[model samples]
Target chain A: MAVYTEVPDDELAAFVKAYDIGEVVSFKGIAEGVENSNYLLATTKARFILTLYEKRVNRDDLPFFLGLLEHLSAKGLTCPQPVAGRDGEALRMLCGRPAALVTFLDGVSVRRPTARHCAELGRALAELHETGKGFALRRPNALSVSGWRPMAEAAKGRSQAVSPELDAIVAAELDHLEATFARLDLPKGVIHADLFPNNVFFLGDRLSGLIDFYFACDDAFAYDVAICLNAWCFEPDQSFNVTKGRALLSAYHATRPLEPDEVAALPTLARGAAIRFLLTRLVDWLDTPAGALVKKLDPLEYLKKLRFHQQANDATAFGWRP
Target chain B: MAVYTEVPDDELAAFVKAYDIGEVVSFKGIAEGVENSNYLLATTKARFILTLYEKRVNRDDLPFFLGLLEHLSAKGLTCPQPVAGRDGEALRMLCGRPAALVTFLDGVSVRRPTARHCAELGRALAELHETGKGFALRRPNALSVSGWRPMAEAAKGRSQAVSPELDAIVAAELDHLEATFARLDLPKGVIHADLFPNNVFFLGDRLSGLIDFYFACDDAFAYDVAICLNAWCFEPDQSFNVTKGRALLSAYHATRPLEPDEVAALPTLARGAAIRFLLTRLVDWLDTPAGALVKKLDPLEYLKKLRFHQQANDATAFGWRP
Candidate 1:
């Protein structure tokens, strides 16, 4: 729930003049994305989203994010297409921040996603990966296996404050994942590194759109699947629901068949996914200044998820028997 | 920028089932109002605003606020009409908070309002006061003249933290306003006590709608005018712009002719209005828990406005003549 910068009327009018979209009808700050300021912008022609990139987003990586959306939408994906100005530039400046206008996708994010929603999301995820094949830009996933150690070390001693045994569990998991990830040869491609349910929208029971491509990068496709498993298949009790896991994996497999090695690597990738979130969240939980605008998600939630992943011996444990 | 309560999907689906409005298409938390969790709800029929009243609003006062909106809309004022459910109830409990669905009003709020906008707002405000006459439900202005002292007392000694002489200015203004308000007899009616520019919507220089009636109450109509004058007729540098003041007053007077007494009391009411905000803002500044979600407005801004009002001797000083 943030609108850190207020856009003045004159400045907005001037900014809209650069676009081919008709006169601005209405604009409102949307409390959806946490990483940037998002506004539901309506014009005489159509509704769009106006995003002002905040400090958390690296300015250099914006073209990759914007370009990926353009590339995906062009490949028949239901995503926000970056609307270019009359000069054909999608990115511009507004309120002294990097800004862009994208066509609005019509759907609501499902809060408690069912197996059916997970299935639809799985199909969409596979479509995103397949569609992303043609995109030329490459950004390595910063939160991948290589990134975990530094984050875990930063939160190493302090993680016990969250829970007495958290530090030891995280340390053991880090060692296991680091050793396993270094030796794996897996199918790699563009992946929506943070394809959580909140970033996927549903119109009725159908997946209408996928959004918030900020965390997207070039990474193992199985890693993206693992992220979805952690995000979508878990219940309130932190127990993994195998039925939903099977639904997500089978739907994803139907779209793009996983290789034998990729299937075998699922459990390890899922463990890495859990630790990736757990370590980052743990660091954020400790580092966030008290009373900051953003709410720090509970790191212990991912700790519980990591514990579940630790027990899984094979891909069959995740309902994938490839 | 507030969406305090997360309305789960199952609960929202069940809640919307009671409404005659079409099936919900999209729901996004809007970063707009501070006092409530607002969502821009789109259905198959049309867009609507879903407001979940937060703790700042008194539960007992819900009917008055919702009723006033209904009453004003029925009287032909362009404002958000509270949408009644199939059971003919506009108010219901959702996510354990008093909630309501109101017809979405179009148009954007101008950050910097022009005199033309001020004139339109003036006419809309007069229309609101006239329409509100038919509203039977009455809520007293708790932030009016009498409410200032307790708040002033709470922030009295601590006021100097905002400004060096704020305590002295507030003390002097309270005594003056207390004495002046006791001796006044003016026309009283329903007044939108917090008619800031953000609460008024404009579409291409035309006033499209008025909103946020939480502070609407039974008070001297001129006091509402004074609040607007304090809100709208001031420049960024804190100097009063008499051209905008004249435009606002004359337009308002054209719609609802202010009685000689109401006109004569304008300067004093404006002074009291400044102090009213100053005292409340000062209290909020002092009492707000550190790191709270809402941003505490600067009390010194009102202190500056209070100083401007202290020198005005008559209605003519506010660009009005009895």
Candidate 2:
């Protein structure tokens, strides 16, 4: 949501010269993508997104992320393809930051997801998983079940500042997830660990693209489904929209059938997903200074979702039929 | 750069439908223009800048701004033209803010202005004034000579915090300007009062376009030139580049010959122009909260420029020839 680094004009023109893309026509910093400074760079040829990887993102993960986009696009998934320069390198240094130019996809990200949008998202999510098989690169999900404890502990002292019961809720969820998460031996593969509504684009009812794959990593496939259910199936009033859940789940099932164990483990996976987001959002809420450029998303929103997931004892609660 | 408002997807789609442009292909919040939430809206037909006027901008003054763009574009200036909808209305409501779509111009703003860039900017500024000869609507410059004293007084109390000498300098400058600014009779017309380097664009060395007309108002044409000299002639080290000043004033004078009286008042107008920006920037520097999305510019930069202008008693100080 902010362009932290200001690329000099002559430097930009020189950098763009390395690529086969024609002369730079217009360049603008886009108020999009939280972790990186994204610019819409247009040339005589076409428009592309120029991303300067900020310090928050690990530079070592560049190959995996850039390669994954290349691999996914080759597999017929609609995603940004990294445009290699004349030197045959996709990732290079721009203003002392790891940078990449990606072909821009055209679509609008829905602010409020309809049931139809959810269904399209589910299909796309399943397709991403299906196509991401055998990528030959591995990155562990750093914010998964193994990472929740440290995150929660860091925010524990300051947790009560958000709400009186936030600390207790986080502690109990962490305990429950740590005991049950590793036990579930569901299908595992690469997943877009953060598939929020903002990450998926839609052209009317049709899903056009999936982006911000920096979070994509090896994880339980069903865990990604749980992430989506928590993300897209909830209304503004904090109630789960079962119709949206059905649309999302059914479409996903139609694309790639879920295993019996995966279906049975929905309640646990959903709760763990809730805790994953709750802890991170809580840390961010507590860490971000007041009046920072980036808008702090309320961690309590996930706390409310966690409360809802706590009572669901079966897949039926998520509109998943056997 | 920040996007203050988020336009919902459906609202954006319905809004674009009002115009004859095809369905929305892409919509992104642009981190450009401080007073408005600008989105780069792409349809099947073309790319356009959709500007939603935020609360900082006066809503009543919108007609004058939009109408001015239309008038300037009609006069063959390479400025953004306000695109009217099917109902022939360019200004309307979007997300409860006054909004209009203007054709997207192609160019990059030079971060470091060369003598060549300054020459191009001068020509473009002179062209804008010449083309704006008979623009019927008139909006008083709110940050001009008449507006400086109030702004200076607003920042006077806390001026010592910035520097012990700051308050005295502002006081002396304001007194000198108020005494002399009214005595000079100069050619007055519509002027792009805020023609900073960021407001002017270039494709390589060729001047492409000028934008951000929120500050355009009826004022002395030489005052606008003085504003440009203050903006474009200064180097990063706070030294005025006489070469750049010569290029700018020479090119501008070639376009619209400056009267001897107007040339003689360059030092005073330049001082007043420096005060205008210095006072407004001082207010912004003091008023903006820490960690705000909008970056606070250093007001002392203009203070240094004002000090330089204070010593210049003739146009020769600005590289003007008799």
Candidate 3:
């Protein structure tokens, strides 16, 4: 379940009724997250998803979560539009929890994303970020410099393999990251913090929609690009898939060419991004959920990935050959 | 906002009221996850984290997360133990969510962990895994084998960075990972799936506590070691931290020596671990929470990390002299 909150069916029905969409047909629980409770709903008008505000989600932030989608969608980005309630509100109380209904996207999440796909996503994401500047709400970065250290604190132990040199390297890198990226000139805007493959829906070879805007917040635009380079261009062995990297960057560049400063900051930002996930995932891994099909993600994977970024010397390494 | 959940204060009070150790304090959210909602509470007698089973939390699998902590704690591993409710059940219910309160650890997470810290973590993890055998429960490795393909599928079109050359390399590496590690001799047991820095807490120079055991599952023990090499032993720029790496591996070995096969598989396993995180994180990045504090992590860093591992011909690359 991506949503950890529990909302009864009847309450969900009432919640949907508040929305201006047509009619509700059926709704059932679709457990697919290690965090929240998500349900797929088929309305007479269209299919939609109903996410209950779960434990991993704060009820107070529902407006940002729901409003961001609405804001982005309004700006012409193809994303889920949150349904407002009877009082012209996007949020509603369901089963004693905060919940909302969103338009169900039609395209399937691409499994075989191509260079073209990456480029398209890059362009689309840049446009989204640019347009998001006009959004009615504002949110601070969720995984910025502040969050990284605390997460590292969470995964300090539980390692069965220890290497002194390894510790020194990470410490040095952290210092470098703190010092270097601290002063880089980069664009700051609303970024889709979690720009992974599964969140993007494609119609054929084209990116049809972007889903899951929960991590959207104000941060460096280059960070998003770096994140895309990492997410779209990496293979299962943690190696840089240059072909994919080039395509993603090219597409993004077409939309918004990266400034030299942003490009220069890529390596360090990349490390910071890797460390952010490694720490968070490690913390999450150590603490399992009571009942769910979610699996513990390996944090070390990001650790090694961070190491790779540290040694990278060429922009071409990320698959950009120009 | 650290904890994404709420364990009703009264329900938590009722559950803890029966505990033999101490007084029950109000339950409060801990707010530091993309998965579970954790709460820190004060009992008249002790401090504990009250976890409300979130959507991602499985009520049935409560034993694995809760039990492992107890088991590890029992064996002198510093970690939080699940507190049973008045009903003789480790799982409790509050506000319609399955809940349990775990012992509050008395240590802060280390910000600048040293090689000695890595070594201590390695020993503690090895001890935990070694003593975790023959537990009353079992869980399959969810992130193993079949998981990769699905992630690759989601990333296909978007992996523009994966040139044909890299694709071939990645494909070959995956095959090698399956074949090379297939027949390796190693002990299997419940291991901490995520051994990053934050999960383990420290009291000054010594290791004080480990928290968050959500991803603890049955798998190869050395995989945990490989995970550490990838996590605790790396510099931010992906450089190998020898001092910390040695300390970590040495400590782990002292507790549980590695088999030759496990040693041979170390590089590949480390690579595989990197890939695992790269894929999952990439997937998540694409589907970032619509309105949550969770940040989008970098995937490029891992890609670079994988490349380094691919070129790594010596254990010393990981800061290990052995």
Q: How high is the TM-score of chain A in each model?
A: 0.98, 0.98, 0.90
The clash count for each model shown is: 0, 1, 108
Clashing pairs in 2: A291-B291
Ranking by lDDT: 2, 1, 3
Q: Give the alpha carbon lDDT tens digit for every residue of B1-322 in model 2.
A: 7788999898998898899989999999988988888999999999999999988899889999999999999999999999999999999899988899999999999989999999999899899989999899999888877788888788887888777888888888888887898677889989999999898889889999999999988989999999999999999988999999999999999999999989999999999988888888889989988667677888899889988998898999998877
Best by DockQ: 2
Give the per-residue lDDT of model 3 (tens digit) for A1-322: 3345534434555566676675544343453334566666655576667776666666666788788888888878898898776688777667766777787665545444677788778888878877788777778876777666666555455433433343445556667777876666688888888888777866546777888777888789989888777677667788777778777777777777788777777787787788777667766766755343355667677877887888877566676656
Model 3, which residues run further than 4 Å from truth? A2-6, A161-169, A289-292, B1-322
Query: In candidate 2, residue A14 scores what lDDT?
Result: 88
Ranking by DockQ: 2, 1, 3
Please state the CAPRI-style docking class of candidate 1: medium
List the global CA lDDT of all models. 0.88, 0.91, 0.69
- Candidate 1 lDDT over A8-124, as tens digits, reads 778999999999899888788888788788889888999999999999889999999999999999999999999999999999999999999999988878878899998998899
Candidate 1 lDDT over residue span B27-145, tens digit each = 88888787899998889999999999999999999999999999989989999999999999999999989999999988888877888988998898888888888689889889887
